[model samples]
Target: MENNRVKKQPPKKNLWKPEEDLILKKYVEAHGEGNWATVSQKSGLKRGGKSCRLRWKNYLRPNIKRGRMSQEEEDLIIRMHKLLGNRWSLIAGRLPGRTDNEVKNYWNTHLNKISPLGKRKHVDSNDQNNTNSTETTNKKSKIHTYPVISIDAQKNPTKESNGKKEEGSTSLLNPLMTDTKSFSYDTESPFIATNTSTFFFDDEPLITYMDSFALFEGFGYTTGENYAELGMQLVSP
Candidate 1:
């Protein structure tokens, strides 16, 4: 620095003007859009190729659906947000004539506050209140006791000729004593009945349909091995 060596200054960024835009558009129209660096050089614009390309794509692109989003578009954006979550590029890809920048801006301005996560919190709070009320009611109500008949396998245990207990000697609950209905896998007895049609592969529709039935109260079903041991509480409403 003491030797008086002058430092090289960076070139100033080109401030885009209407004339430059016209030149870029004219060049693109003539060549039908290929090689942006070549286009920038040929267009005689001071801006870089990337900057020109971005300006053209985001602003000057033809058939871009501008103005306020429709109700259908808003609903689609909400659903896509739930599935994709802030992946604006991917979301924009699904929405025709919409840009990632537009989607991101819209989400930031509007959808962030009334998102599904916020709605879920409201629903959960309401459910908690309902549960508290139900608990209070249950505490005040008279509790009725039911007899539990436990059929022990050891009482009349199945044994081999050597006096060892057989492998199949497992305790079973007496069907007559309990309020619950037992369905055999071999039989075609319907455990759940619904008028609504449900796809065989999709469990959601079937579960939703069954949830409407008031016969089974305070019971939940899980997937895999836990599903086999579904407990039904006989609650008289």
Candidate 2:
């Protein structure tokens, strides 16, 4: 059996007037955009409902975060794409207020600018040790400062007696570490993986915060010196 599914295309002259925008926005909000034919008929736009839907999604959504991605953001998308492949929707989740289309377009456009050396390195194959790329030195400096926050409880050992820390408790101190070489997790620090080459922490809170975690282990540490013992027990196995 032959299957025929025609691809939809945006109109050649895709100029959107204020009145048309209002009508489409109103209709989409009132009834949503599933049946495009009905949307065109009811919304009274000169263009197809699919066009309206595309415009609304690709541009007019209230949550859409417009503007060129900062260098750090560009690096993040590159890094995440390596981990997620073409799963733009999943990548979009990490970047609030940005659509998958925006990420996709940005990835397509700016990616070439970042990698002018002519090869599109598969994100998965990129070596973490090789920080040098086609990107400018200024952009590279921005990437070095981007914060990587994770919720994994194993890497960061808490000295507090509580077994689990709530979400939103960690601060973004540095870019999240990734590498082509796989590594195992062996630690008591909920924030640090065993093979991590560098550790960044907020000096003011880490001691007290880790102490609070010690309470979870049925330990009563009366002094800061005891944290080593707690850390040893937490990572003993």
Candidate 3:
């Protein structure tokens, strides 16, 4: 009975060849975009209209930027992401020569990992928990916290009076070092530094510290009483 109920699977999609690609490209070039259904039928390709449309828009489109995104493009993507969320098509419109699929892929592969807002949302979602003793105990036992540090390299390192490289000086602290920008130490051990200039701190300790500082600043509390109250709230059961 189980074997009889099993459904037959569909055949695999045909792998597009260079000649098929050329035919599709020439068809679109001669006729111009749209009418993909007709193009698919007339081009003699086994792929569907949607597939042809995506191939043309994402790969065959003229002036499409194919390399790694520039700093400016990355910044724009970050800002646009914040404003528009995951509306990739809308975001792609703001970035000239970039396709929606490219922007979406970049965000998923790269930006999402480094995005502070994304991390904060993830942390907040995970932080929401019941206050029951058993639940709290289970959550706390499972939680693995690690130290995170953010280090900002001074834009200009102090130079030697003699204008000569100091003996035994490394580039990590060298003022003249032009490549490294900023770096972060995270939950992962042995943090690897990069050639960027901005650093982000995503650890719970840093977030707690920032929250406390903000609360203190907002309340304009200069007295020990306020500090005591704040400390109590932070440690309260």
Local distance difference test, each candidate: 0.46, 0.48, 0.51
Residues 20-79 of candidate 3 have per-residue lDDT tens digits of: 888889989989889888887887877789989998888887877789998877876775
Report the CA-based lDDT of candidate 1 relative to the real structure. Answer: 0.46
Please say which candidate is ahead in TM-score: 2 or 3: 3
Task: Name the TM-score of candidate 1.
Answer: 0.42
lDDT digits (tens) for residues 160-206 of candidate 1? 35535322221224334343322212111122211212111111222
Cα lDDT tens digits, model 2, 12-101, are 776988888888888888886578767887767888767877888777767678887776567657755543345455445446566788
lDDT of 3 at 138: 44
| lDDT winner, 1 or 2 | 2
Off by over 4 Å in 3: 1-15, 116-237
Candidate number that wins on lDDT, 1 or 3: 3
The positional error of residue 227 in candidate 1, measured at the CA in angstroms, is 23
Q: Of the candidates shown, which would achieve the greatest lDDT relative to the real structure?
A: 3
Better candidate number, 1 or 2, judged by TM-score: 2
The alpha-carbon deviation from the true structure for residue 183 of candidate 2, after best TM-score superposition, in angstroms, is 17
